[model samples]
Target: MTPVSSPYVPDVSRYTKRESRAVPVGPIQIGGGAPIVIQSMLTSDTMDTGACVREALDLVEAGCELVRITAPTVKDAANLRAIRDELRSRGCPVPLVADIHFKPEAAMEAARWVDKIRINPGNYADRKKFVVRSYTDEEYASAVARLEDAFLPLVHLCQERGIAMRIGTNHGSLSDRILNRYGDTPLGMVESALEYARICRKAGFHRIVFSMKASNPRIMISAYRRLIAVLQELGPDWNYPIHLGVTEAGDGEDGRVKSAVGIGALLADGIGDTIRVSLTEDSVREIPVAEALRALVEEFAGAPRPKEALVPPFDPFSFQRRHSHRWVRNAKVGGGEPVRVAVLEENFAALESASAGTEMVPELGYRPGMAEEVDPEDPATLAELETGAPRLVTVRDGCPYPPLYAFRMLAARIPSRHPILLKDTFFPGEKGDPLRERLNSALQVGALLCDGIGDAVLLRREADPKKALELSYNILQATGNRSFKADFVACPSCGRTLFNLQETTARIRAATGHLKGVKIAVMGCIVNGPGEMADADFGYVGGAPGKVNLYVGKKAVRFNIPQEQAVDSLIALIAEEGKWIDPPRS
Candidate 1:
């Protein structure tokens, strides 16, 4: 859960119980003051009437309030009727939604049978040649006008049929105008959807859901967050249901984790109305994943949970595989009894008690991990701050070996700013001056002060005969200090400190500015250097002149270096440790 500072908690709390205007579908009410709805789409061909019905029923059993079917062509659009009829015949009353691309006929066909229709404004505009393909102002306006006219009729048809509409904007199919304005950000997707949503509102149809989907989880999460923020400010009175999804969310576990993190983030903040866990694999896989993610919210809100009992009949067609029927039934049942899962406060106690099985009780309240009493004397205060700043620290490596270069390459590989910290400034007393005591004190104080103000700090260390830099970095990370800097551990070399240790260390530190929240170490003297540098995200040690040991965590990667050019070699190594720059002190 994203910890809310006291001040922002109210901002979030405002929406917690605020009722939204309901958007009605056969038996379900979306948007206006409804339960957080779980939804998914069928990957089976829509034209395969039997397959579509089977998938839809599966999703319904999984607890899906609605299921969207892709109607790419007029032929596919006809499946909506067959699918809806099949569901109704089977005693499943779930609403069917048609997802159409560009063809207006497809939309019309689905609108006749499906309860809802989702259309891409960009795609609709793409078919009608109005805009000059070449960038020209006069041609663009003319195209925009034609595009608006093209969608106005579809909006009118939806209004006439009393069909709900979702203006889904994909990252791939952005409007040229919006793309030019906002670039290809999730924001652009939001703006594009908003333009269509505005058209719908003007057409006197308030039944709407907006979706902005991206293949990238980070981009998807940020776009949704921003969209909610904008809607909160722009249409406080209007609570149109928002559809959540991670488009093209890969396949299997990789897809599941990404979608979970992205959707989970928004749902945790109480932003989503309906969620779809998009996966490249069969849409059937999407059902269970969506239900699980929504279950988190249920668990958090202390709402009724799905029955933990294994499927009684273990039927392959059981709804448990599609949606959490148990949870929804519990919600409908409304006895307000809690559901329980296995959670032991003390594993040792559970192990010790031979007769004890899993505790079966209702979820009463939030159980935070690692609860501890706050100590006033601790420099960092848990009291939430008003700043909406994130509380993440970067992890970087400051080793001066081949691994450092590996770190650098990784940093360069990332599209965004390397989040690890950079460590360049040497702490006082590295040379073992009598000032070592004062330096350690200064460093610790610096850490505490930075942490109190919500900063990520990096602990830079040296490669010595005894410890690895990663060990030091981990020790600091365990502090959960917002003021954490990447750990930079450098060696204290003497005239006998073999392998241009000083020069390599300094250059490695200089190279770390790009990365953030990293712990790196540069050490000399093979005999004790490797062991001395512990807890470093990356480590580079002086290993007999032309060779150096590079480490990620405690694992070493072998690298050969020429003794005469060891400093440059070390620089190359540290660079590979990715970005390990210290976060800016608060």
Candidate 2:
């Protein structure tokens, strides 16, 4: 099988969940045709059993079916027993998962306590020293054998205990071997997880799930799609429950949108069994967002799927912007320019005063007859692009399919020469529910953006034009298609976190949000900090309880800056790197 099977056909449609093996995590089921499960990680320290128990209970109470706690060390793994006993003694049967990294002994200890053990293949066997070297086939095989030896103990322990395992691969943490071979691409992430899975398959352990997580939605989406393709190629017995997440997704609206874009996009494509929305907020806060995303999936799960032969509209496993013609000749609507944003011309003036010198300005205005209209649902409209001269084309209003699927069809049918004007969400542009608007924009448009579609986005129906403009930019930034200001990808606090993630992320944003095109990562600890924040130009990671580490990309240049001086030092690093810019005059 290839990254994208030419004329690939999935058994399910964009509106259904793909059938997968149901791995039992305690009393709950993850795939094998089960409802999409919602999960979150506890931010409380593992040694603080009371705090862990309280947070786990809060998450379960808020409808989290599964809870994960980080056990970075053997001692932390041992504390899981206390946390579990306390939770179970209090009548809480919510399934617990041990999040393990860089320690096989810790995973073995954790397997004895939790219902499921999630091992990051990137770090479970190999420490990431960012070593870049070539390895011959013999050396690679030896490394794989060593990895198998280290991982099999935990696999056997999980199987013997009749528990489940999650082979969760993080994009930023691929081992030196995989990185040298695949260069941090989605294919590498899938292979990293598969190496461990193949060993489990050999050991006759079928109770397993898999996840390919990255802070970037494009990578996360592509990696999971590639995983599904490989699993299908491996045959029926290899079907495993898949876990989904966009790690280091920051706080509040922006974070939620980032999560929705990645998770909602795949869920809409009939992928993913369990999901976690990692936000830099309270652990319990993540539950509602995950539930909301799951609800969006189930809402369309029953819709009739298309029966025609399905060819992926674009390359499913790559990040190349589709080759759109320079049809909007007068403007930067196509020809590989950054995805443009447009708002209704009438609504733009209303926000004109507020939009000045900020992110509120839209790149183009949606006047009545600015472009040729192409109804995404109509097969005949697709032919119009070829019949006439190449020009800017937008989806006509009232397409029956959801925007995610509809836009995909448009992308599949339209000529490469015709530039697309994405008209997201077919709702009224009136003051109503803001959450609805945000979700629709994120789920519909944000999803497509990550898929390398949509040359320009027009939020025509959003009542608030300023919000429409901001949402458009947020979607673009979240997908790594464009950046209007400093972009943040922060992990939700976990037991492994050494400092206050929520407070620190907010402070970092306040200090540096003005620097356009600069990306900073605010991480709680090293577990996912160095790897997950690989895309950030500068990194602010929690080094210890009261110390912070600053990084330039994956390289940590500063060991431990005092917590109070960390932000200042980070700013200085930015200045030293020549990325610091003065905030605009008010």
Candidate 3:
């Protein structure tokens, strides 16, 4: 399918508009806004000329605008030329890209066969011929520097021979300094690739494409967003073609979902010129998945996104910007305190009862029906919330007919200013029921589009009030906010279990129950549990059923506390740790 140019977008000056020297890959322009091109790689070894040709044909049929084949070794490079020849013989005119690793020789070899070449900075070293994982920052920097130098000759060749060069960064192969400073973050990946792009520009090479590859959807989206932001800031000179993909995305549902989220988010933002939905399964069938993602993104963008859904002004750096608003503490919150939210009924009595003697309205500045209202049940009403606004809604949690259809109607009538909030009981547990399933579907649909919704989220069982409290804390933490009191990370006991992970965790939670922004993890075994709980500020795990190992940031501070006193002992340790924060009042 040909890409339809968007009418409202002003001409982006970031890229050079010269079409004379540019390579036209089917209907898409590589060096221009020439409607985004979709590209995929051939997993088949190039030496298997027939396999390569067959894969290329399949990809082309699946709507792949361009196909890249791996050219890792010199022999593979020759196979690439044969496959390219076979493609032409079979009447498949899809543009071919050569996936090149660090070797300049390999790049130069494939430069003769493929339409485009992707050079990753993660491979090759200055003095050494090659090295895969250079763990040190200096080594990584040197590799990238060397990669830039090696790439110039290839870029020069591309310019001479009329092939495009894509500077790509793989998340798994990131340099030591980048990993140390950024820790598998998209910012680090974008910055690393940009550093190479800068080198290419300095060398006077303009035929460029950039990609930051990761299997994780979040990382992929984050990297692309950062790259676009940087490109926008750099002005027209930095605009180059961008290839989208979830690198090594596993097969089946996982691959599809990862590719959709990563590619979809970028496409909606008007980023990404080409895409590849890298999958582990048959490379032949990968084409349809990529096309599906493209179609889905286009369809989503085709739908009119409400302007009111844009995030409100705030710090631009946060992931919070995607939703278009930042929560700023108001005088009502006082001294920049965290916003306190209550999930209650929406009727006059409930609102009156819940809002009475509380700062929810005052902190947020509300007039009854002043901020636009939507049916708490509507899915569409949940999209595009302003930044930092805590959602408020009412749900008939206990009612049999929770008003699904009515909510849908109310959703369409909702004004953009307000987000939806529903009561907790509306959402059923993981166990399925029709009413519960419908609510979950609505909630997911709303959340997926960046719409905000709230529920006094339910727990598995209410018999143990402690379980409900713990569950609530977990829910708030998942949202990236931790204003809730005490999060307990406990594991389910298995045959390998040594201690009472459930009861012991409960006791610790009870002791620190009043403390907000604190997390305690309880695990079944001492061996892997402590290591897994490294992120927690404090943790305890069963060494044996009666003994426990205590930790603070992965450091084994205390060992083998008896089971009977384990909870109390951990509580005392927490009291000591509490000094790090201002002391809590009685």
Which predicted model would earn the best lDDT? 2
Q: Any residue pairs clashing in model 2, and if so which?
A: 20-32, 21-32, 22-32
Which segments of model 1 are wrong by more than 4 Å?
1-19, 127-140, 302-586
lDDT (Cα) of model 3 = 0.53
2 versus 3: better lDDT goes to? 2
Q: What TM-score should be assigned to candidate 2?
A: 0.95
Which window of 10 residues has the lowest lDDT sum in candidate 1? 314-323
For model 1 the TM-score comes to 0.52
Give each model a TM-score: 0.52, 0.95, 0.54
**Model 3: residue 438 alpha-carbon error in angstroms:** 15
Tens digit per residue, CA lDDT, model 1, 56-149: 7877776778888777678888867887888899999898888776688888778888778888755655532222245467765676667677
Give the residue spans of candidate 3 off by over 4 A: 1-28, 124-147, 180-183, 305-309, 312-586
What ordering of candidates by TM-score runs from best to worst? 2, 3, 1
Q: Encode model 2's per-residue lDDT on 9-113: one tens digit a residue.
A: 363235655788778889999998888899999888889999898888888889999999999999999999999999889999999999988888999999998
- Against the correct fold, how does model 3 do in TM-score? 0.54
Clashes of each: 99, 3, 12
Q: What's the residue-level lDDT of 149 in candidate 1?
A: 78
